[model samples]
Target: MAYLGVDIGTSSSKGVLVDASGTVIATAVRAHTVSRPRPGHVEMDPEVWWREFRDITRELLSGHLGGPDAKGGAGPASGASGGSSPTGVGVGRPGPVAAVGISGMGPCVALADGASRPLRPAVLYGVDTRAVAQIARLDAELGRPAVLDRCGSVLSTQAVGPKVAWVAEHEPEVFAAARRLFMPSSFLVHRLTGAYVLDHHAASQSVPFYDTGAEDWYRPWVDAVWPHMELPELRWPGDRAGTVTAKAAAATGLAPGTPVLTGTVDAWAEAVSVGATRPGDLMLMYGTTMFLIATVTRQLRVPELWSTVGAYSGTRSLAGGMATSGAVTEWLRGLFGAADRAVLLAEAEQSGVGARGLAMLPYFAGERTPIADPDARGVIAGLTLEHTRGDLYRAALEATAHGVRHNVEAMRRAGAAIERVVAVGGGTRGGLWTRIVSDVTGLPQDIPTVTVGAAYGAARLAAAHLEGEAATAAWNPVRDRCVPDPAAGAAYDGLHRLYRELYPATRDTVHALARLRREAAGTEDAASGGAPS
Candidate 1:
C-alpha cells in the first residue's frame, strides 16, 4: 500500500511514491515559475499551489529509503506485503498511503473566495493569452454553432469560459469577491478535501461551462458565463474526492483520513501515465507545453481539436495543445547561455535537418491546438549571420515538430483514429526531441516505462483508486521506439509545408505586435497602480 501523486506543472511541481507492486516509491520536485503578469498574462499563486503541495508532501514523506513515518503514520493494510524491486524500484516498507492523487496544468481559472482565498492570480492555462476579448465576447454572445454544439470546444484560449469572462469584465473587485472555481486539480482538491470537487476531465475543459453531451453542468452556459460563481462538484478522474483534512493533515504529512483521488488535467494525467487510455490512443505530452491526448471512441468535434471527457468514465478525448514545446527549447537555452539540457541537446544534435534553413513558429505562448491563435506570434522564418545557437536550437526542435504535424493533421481531421503514439514528458528525454517528432509526424513514438509524468499519472490514478489495480499497464511499459525516418521524408515534407505556411504568413504582423505589446502592458499597469492583469 502506497500511492500519493501530484502534478501542477507548467514549470514544475511533481511528486510520486507508488508501490503495492507498481514500483516507483519516492520522487519529488518543485521548481516553479509562471507569472508573466502582462503580455498575454499567465499566472500562478494559488498560494504557489499550496506551497508546492506542502513542499512535495514533505519531500516524499522524508526519503532516504525508509518511508512514511516522519509524521505520515498509518502503515500496512491493503494486500499487506508490499512488492517491486528487481529494478522496478519500490524496495518495500513504505506501507499504507492508499490514495491521494492529483494533476494540474489545466483549463485553469482558480477564482475562489468564501474562504477558499485566491481571487486574483490564477487565470492561466491555454498559455494565458489574456482572454482574447473574452474569446470574442463568448463567441458573440454564445453562438458559434451553439458553442461547438454544446461545448465540445470552440471558444478558445482554451476555454474556462473566456477566463471567467476575463474576471467578470476586468476584475470587478475580483469578480465581486468570487465564490469558487479552481483548477490545478481542483485547487489541490480544495486544499486536500475540503472538497469543492471538479474532475470530469477538468469539467470537460470548462468550455461553454461543460455539457459534452450532457455529462453535466451546462446550466445555460452557467447562466451566461459565471453568474456569480460557485460550481465545482464534478468528480471522475478516478472518483473518491474526499478525505485528508485535519487542516489537510497538518499541511501534508498525509494520514488524517487519507483517500483523496478526484484528479485530472496534466494532459489527462499524462494520459493516465501512458497506458494512453485505449480507443486508438495517442497521448503525446512532451511538456512545458505540447500536449495531444486522443483516446477517442466518440465525440470527436474539431474546431481544430479538444473534445474533452475521458480521464476514465466511458472515455472520449481529442485534445491538442502547443503554446510552446519544451518551451521553445527553454527559450533557446536561455538565449544560448546554455548551462544545461545537455548543452542544448548537444547543439541541437549538430543542427541538422532543416534547422539549417530554419522556419520556426512554436508561437512562443500564443497558440494552441489547431490554430487557436491567441495573437499568435513567434515566427523566426530563416535567419542570418549564418544561424547558430545550433541553428536556433534546431529551429526550436523543428518548430515543435511542425506543431506535432499540425496536431496530427488536426487529429486526422477530427475523425481521430490515431492508432498508437504514446511518448510522454520531460520532452521524452533527449533522442533529438523524439527524433524530431518522428520525422515530423510521419508517426511512431511509444517510449514509456515510467516517464514520471503527471507525477506518474497521479500515481497511476492513486493506484487505480486505492488498489483495485490496473496500475497503468502494470506500472508503465513499452520502453522504447521512435521509428519514422524514411530518409527524413523529403525534409519533413518541405518543413511541414512551411510549418503550414508560417501561420497565415505572419498573422497581420503578429496581430500588430500583439497590439503594441498590449499597449505597453497597459501603460505599465497604469504606472504601477496596477490593473491590466
Candidate 2:
C-alpha cells in the first residue's frame, strides 16, 4: 500500500503519495500566501489550511476505487499511480492507502475553543514579531536562567508562549474563549483522528511551557502563561497519533481507521526527507525562509540558537532560521515586475560576486536566531544610481549567504559538530542560490534526489510506521554536492565581515523606524505578502 503525506506550508499546502520502496508515485501542491494585517503582524485563517488539505488529498487519491487486478489500462485525470506493484497499484486503480503523515510551518499559536474551532487567525512563527514586548516581560517574570535550563533556549520572537501571551494581553475576547492550543501539524492531526497530541519537537519551541530536559510540558509555566488552557499530548514525530475517524475520512477521502503518524515542524520533516538524522548532520532547507537544522549529540543550549528535541526521540537539534530568504527575493521580484523567476536568477548570476559593489541585509521580516532582532529592517548599502536590477538581486542572494554563515558560526560556538550538510526544499532547485551559500559558508551541501521536501519526509515516516525501521533506511539518497570555490570563499570572508557590521551599524535607526510605524498603525487593507511560508 502507498503512504499519503501532507504538509501545510507558509505559502502553500503540498501533498505526496509514495510507495513502500520510497518511489514517489505522485505529488501535488496548492499555492497560497499569508496575510500581513499590520506591521510585524503575520496571520492566516486556520480554515484555509484544512480547505487546501482537503483539495490536495482528494486530488492525490482521485480515480475510481476499483480492483487493481481487474483494471484495463486504468489511467485517468490528474494523479500519480498507474503500474501495478506488490506494495501499491497506480492512481485510478485500487491503491490502498497504508498510513497518513502530517506536517506544517510551526511552532505557530493557533488558539482554539474547547470544541477545536479556531478562535482567531493563527499567529505565525518567528517572522511575526508582534510579541516583542511580551518576550521581554516573560524573560523577566520567569527568570532567564530558569527558562534556559527548562526550555533549552531563551525567550525570543519564535517562542510560542510569548505569542500566546500577546493574544491574552491584547485580544482578551479571543483569549477568554480559547481552551485548546494547536500548531499546524497538531491541528491537522487532530482534525484527522480527533487525537489531542503534538510532537516533542514542536512542543519544545513553546519555550517556557515545555521542559526540554524533562521532555514534557511544564504545567506550572503553562499555567503561568495562559491559565486553564489544555495542552495536547506530546509524542515523537514518527509515533502513531491515532486512527483516522469516519468524519475525517469522509471529508478528505483518507480511509477510516487508517493510522496517522505524529509530525513536527516543516523544516524537521524536510530534514528527515534527506536522512540528516545522525549527529554532525545538518539540513539546510532553502524555502521562503531559510532554515538550518543541525542534529547534535546532545542538547546544545545557547541564547542565540534554538535547541529543541529532534524529530525523533533519541536525537536532539540546535537550529537557526533566517527571517526572510526567498521572501526578500520574491519582494524584489515583485518590485521589478520580473515575469519569470528564471530570468531574475540569470540576471543575478550575470551581476556576479559583489552585486556591483552593493551589499544587503535580508531582514525584511526581522531577524531570527544569532541576531534575534525583530526590529531589524532590510538594508541595501553602497547602491549607486547606475546599479541594475540584476545587481540588486545578486546582492540579495549574497545577503542570505552572509546570514547563513552567521548562523553556522553560532551553531559551532554552541558545540554542534556540523559535518555533513544536506540541502532540501524549493530553493535548491536553482543551482545559483546553493552555489552562493556554499561559497559564503565554505561548506559543501549534499542535495538529495527527491527535493519535494516535507511531504516526502512525512511519507517516509509513514512507511516506517507500517514496515518497521528498515522501511525508511534507504529512502532519499544524495545525488549531487555543492562545493565551495576557494577563490570565491576568500572574497566572501571579507564581504561577510562587512555584512555582520552592517546590521549593528543600522540597528538603532531601524528600531526607531519600527517604533514610529507601530505608533502610527491601523490599516484597513490586509496585504497578502511574504515569499513562501
Candidate 3:
C-alpha cells in the first residue's frame, strides 16, 4: 500500500507518495506566493492551501502510487503483495492509501467562523511582524516573565497569541466571527476529516496560550488575550486525528475512511524526515527562512530562542530561526538578472572566504532569534564598485552562516546539549550553502539520503503510523557529511565578528529609515507594531 504526505510551505505546496519499503513512489509541487497587503504584514488566502492540496493529490494519485484496478488501481511501485496491518488498514495491498499525513509552515493564525469558513487571509509566522503592538501590550499586561516561565517562549512575532489579539483589536469584524484557529496542517486536517485538532508542537508556539509545564492550554492566559474563541483540540504530530470523510474522499480521490495523522509545523516534520529527534540532535532547515530545531530533554526558556513540545510525544525542543537565509541569495540572484542558480553557486564558491572583504546582515525580513528585532533591516557593508554579483551572493550566504552561529551560541548558553547536527531542505541541495554554513559555524552536518523536506517527513510520519516508529527511523540515513574547514573557518571567524558588529552599528539608522519609508508609503499606523526589546 502507499501513504501520502502533503506540506503547505511559504512559497509552495508539495505532496509525496511512498510505499511500505520506504521508497518514494511519486512527488508533486504547486508553486504559489504569499500576499504582502501592507508593510510588515504577510498573509495568504487559506483557500489556496486546500486548492493546491486537492490539485497535488490528484496529480500524485495519477502517478506511480498504484494499487489494483477493480480493487482500486495500483501505481507502478506497488510491488508488495496484498496484506493487512495491525490496524486492519490493508497496509501492503488493498488500501491504496494506508494513511495520510499533512504538515505546513506554522505556527500561523488562520481564523475561521463556526462553520469552518475562513474570516480573512491567514496571518503567517514570524515574517509577518504586524503583531508587534499586540506582543508588547500582551507582554506588559500578562507579565513577560510569567509568559516565559509558563509558555517556554517570549511573545514575539512568532507567537500566535499576539496575532489573534491583533485581529481582535484591529479587525474587530473578523474577531467577532472567529471561532476556530488553525495552522496549515490542522487546517488541512479540518478540511479532510472534519476534525478540530492541532498538534501540541504547533499549539505550544501559540505562546502563553499553551503552558509548557501543564502540556495544555493555559486557560486563564488564553482567555485573557483571546476571549471567546474555540481553539483546536491538541494532539501529537503523529497521532491519528481521524479518517477521511466521504465528502473529502470524493473531493481528493482519497478512499473513504482512510486514516489521517495530526501533522505539525514543516521544520519539525522535516526533522523527522532526516531522523533528527534524539536528544542533542539539531535539524537545520534551509529554506525561505533558516530554522534550527534542537531536540532536548530539558525545557529551558531562553529569551532568544523558542522552546516548545517536540513533534513526538514526551519530547521537547529548543528552536531558533532567522528571518531569511536562502531568501537573501534568491534576492541577490534576482538583482543579478536571476542567474542560473548552479552557475551562481559556482561563482560564489570562487568568491572565496570573506566574500572579497564584504560582510552582511541577513535581516531582509527583520529577524527572529538571538536578535528578535522586527525593526532590524538588512545591511550590506564594505562594498565597492569593483565587487561582483558573485561576491554579493557569497556575502549573503556568509551572513546567514553568522546568524546560525549566533543562534547556536545562544542554544549552548541555555544548556542545550547539541551533539549531532543534520541539515535538511532545498537550501541543502546546492551544497555550497551547506558547506559555507559548516565552515562558518564549525559544525559538520550530516546530509541525509532523502532531503525532499517536510512533505517527505509527513510521508515518514504516515509510514510510522502504520509500521511503528522504528521502521521509519532507518528509512532515511546520512548519505554525506559536510565537514568544516579549519582554514576557511579561521577566515570566517573575522568576517563573522564584523557581521555581528555591523548589525548594532546600523540598527538605529535602519530603524529610522524603516519608519520613514513606512510614513512615506502612508501605511504607518498605531497598529503597525514597533520593534521589540
Best candidate according to TM-score: 3
Give the clashing residue pairs of candidate 2, or none. 1-87, 10-533, 11-533, 81-90, 81-91, 82-90
Report lDDT per candidate. Answer: 0.77, 0.85, 0.86
Off by over 4 Å in 3: 66-95, 526-529
Per the 3 Å backbone cut-off, how many clashing residue pairs does candidate 2 have? 6
TM-score of 1: 0.37
lDDT tens per residue, model 2, 137-256: 787899988899889999888999989998888888999999999988899899899999999999999888999998999999999988889988889999999999999887777779
The C-alpha RMSD of each candidate to the native structure, in angstroms, is 19.5, 5.3, 5.6
- What clash pairs does model 3 have? 66-74, 66-75, 67-73, 67-74, 67-75, 68-72, 68-73
Cα misplacement distance, residue 344 of candidate 1 (Å):
37
Better of 1 and 2 by lDDT: 2
lDDT of 3 by residue, 278-348 (tens): 99999999998999999999898888999999998899999999988888888888888879999888988
Better of 1 and 3 by TM-score: 3
Give per-model TM-scores: 0.37, 0.93, 0.94
lDDT of candidate 2 vs native? 0.85
Ranking by lDDT: 3, 2, 1
Best by lDDT: 3
